[model samples]
Target: MTAHFVDLLDDLRRRSLRMAQLVEEVVREACEAVFQADVEKAKRVVQRDNDVDAEEVEVESEVIRLLALYQPVGSDLRLLCTVLKVNNDLERIADCAVNVAERARHVDARTLAGPYEDLRQMGPIVVHMLHNAVKAYGSQVVDDAQRVLLEEDAVDALYGQIIRRLVAEASASPAKIAAFLDVLSVAKNLERIADHATNIAEDVVFVCTGEIVRHRMH
Candidate 1:
């Protein structure tokens, strides 16, 4: 690749990382919005979704332009592909964050503290997992990516526990059904965010090693 092309690729990667950071903040805000039942914070998250969407489109366009104009080979090409894939995942995570934030108005975290424990634990793990994935992508280090992958199982396990607890506990607490659904929705979105974070980590591994690690053992 030409020096100019390399410069452009580096710029694009940085742009993608900035987007990831924005998405990560949004996820944190979403968690706070719902857990604290702060309607205003949730609204801010919804507004920021527009910015994330616009950035995602811009990054994707740059990827396509580079692919057609420069036709990078080997690792350069792998990097372009990783940026594109990571961009998509980041956008999806933003959408999930929005979903979680929207559920804030219905949640009463204090009242639902019994069921909210696992979900509360789940949120920060997913956020840290996302942070690790973004850091790995920026550093292009397989070890950093593996850190993200390692946390996915913990998030998944917590999600499962939430589902089971909600199912078993909801029947007895019929009056709080609305709040229960809101809690479930938040848990589902958090689980999805973890999944997307894992996808980014898997892409990072692929970029660094030229090996696909999606469906197989880690």
Candidate 2:
């Protein structure tokens, strides 16, 4: 690779990493705001989503520029493509965080039955997947990408349990029905964030191995 090509690739890598960091922060903060019932923090998460969207646009533009300018082939080409896909995924994850924060902001006075332990559990799992998927992309680690994929089932299982418990609780409590439903919606958003993270991990795998394993693996 020419010096110019290497420099361009490095720029793409750095920008993608920055975007990942911002998205992960938004997700974490949104979860915390929900748990703490901090309306101000939730508002911040909502407001910061625009910045994540802007970052996605910037990453997409950079990827296209690299494609046009350097015409990267093989691994370089795959990395650029994965960056484009993963950029979209990260932006969508941020949008999910915003949705969760929005739900938190309008919560009624009635207390949510018990703590949101399951939602809390899902948060770190998704965050770790986001971190590992991005790290794998940065280092071109195909195995790490696959590991992220394997972790998605756990998120899905947790989501299922959350749904069942919330349904039962909401059905039992007529008074706190609305609050329970809001909590359920928030959990759904968190689950979707994990789904988006998994999508990015799959893109990373393709970027590294040239294999689209989306449908092949359950």
Candidate 3:
């Protein structure tokens, strides 16, 4: 029974790592599509969302099977629960990537007068956060998880800068309104992706320390 349970836990961890890698690819390609103005990459991101959805369903099914078969208690139960929460976070991150890709497809590259820089800055931060959050989950390291949480502020600040730039551009050229708005939407999606990464970090903390840090549980 002990060996079987350990094997199940390992399988869950492996599945989570795979999910994390897929999400990272999604975010990376989405940003590449936007910044490079690569329509094909953007379309690929949109097309691949279904694959992430299917992976989510598969992971959930595996978790459910493990729960019913082992009826995990204590730490085992916590691990299973954390996997479910993180699974949701990863899926949502993929959705956000698709949103960014769609926005990229709408953006008129000719009208975009070099103001997509903020989105470029926002991309790496969120990507790093997602990568580190997954590392925290895989290694069960609280510090890595905490780092992901703390980096949220950086992304928020970048978003503010992006907003200020967009407002200035909108005032300067009303004709560019549609293009600027698309850029803004892309930045917003990246910010929300960072938020989901933070949620994953919080889940990692709970899985490790057995403390729910999501909200004030009073």
Candidate 4:
């Protein structure tokens, strides 16, 4: 490939990274809206999801253009594919963050703060998982990506604990059923975000090692 292609690839990679930064900020604000009961933040998150969706289309268009025009081989090809997959996962994660934000508008984290400690804890852990996954995508480091794989277990465990507690306690405080379901929705979306982050991490490993580790024993 020519130096021109290299320059194009670099620019596309940077564009994707900027999109990642935007998605990360949206997720963080969604979590903040949940804990802080800030309806304004929740609204901002929804607005940014549109931005993410548009960026997703643009990034994908650029990838297709590069593949068609340059037909890169070897590492360049892998990196482009990784950027495309990561872009998709980032978009989905942004959608999940929007889901959480919508829930935040209705149910403040404080309402369920006492009994559902695990629900609150899941937010930051999921965010950290996403942060690390995005870091791995940017760094293309297997070690960083592997660290994200390790985190899924904690998130799954916390999700299970939250569900169990919600079930056990909902009947006791019948009046708070609405709050319980809100907590459930938040936890469910957080778990989904973790899953998406893990997917991004796996793609990063694929980029670095060229090994498809999707269903492998992590």
RMSD to the true structure for each prediction, in A, is 1.2, 2.2, 2.4, 1.2
Per-model CA lDDT versus the true structure: 0.91, 0.82, 0.86, 0.91
Candidate 4 Cα misplacement greater than 4 A, ranges: none
- Residue-by-residue lDDT tens digits, candidate 3, 49-153: 889899999999999999898889998899999898889888999999998888767876554435566667788888998889888888888988898888998
> Tens digit of lDDT per residue, candidate 1, span 2-64?
999999998999999999999999999998898788999999999999999999999999999
Backbone clash numbers for all candidates listed: 0, 0, 0, 0
Checking candidate 2 for backbone clashes, the offending pairs are none
User: Total clashes, candidate 4?
Assistant: 0
Stretches of candidate 1 off by over 4 Å are none
C-alpha lDDT (0 to 100) for residue 78 of candidate 1: 95
Arranged by TM-score with the best first, the candidates are 1, 4, 3, 2
TM-score of each: 0.96, 0.90, 0.91, 0.96
* lDDT tens readout by residue for model 2, 1-218: 59988888888889888888888889888877876778899999988899998888888888988898888889888888888888888989999999888876766423433456777788788778877877776777778888888898999998898888877877888888877778787878988988887887788778868989887664
Candidate 2 wrongly placed segments (more than 4 Å): 108-116
Ranking by lDDT: 4, 1, 3, 2
On the 0 to 100 scale, the lDDT of residue 6 in model 3 is: 95
The runs of at least 3 residues in candidate 3 whose Cα sits more than 4 Å from the true structure, single-residue gaps closed, are 109-113, 215-218
lDDT of 1: 0.91
Worst 10 residues of 2 by lDDT: 107-116
Compared with the true structure, what per-residue lDDT tens digits does model 4 show for residues 14-73?
999899989989999999988788899999999999999999999999999999999999
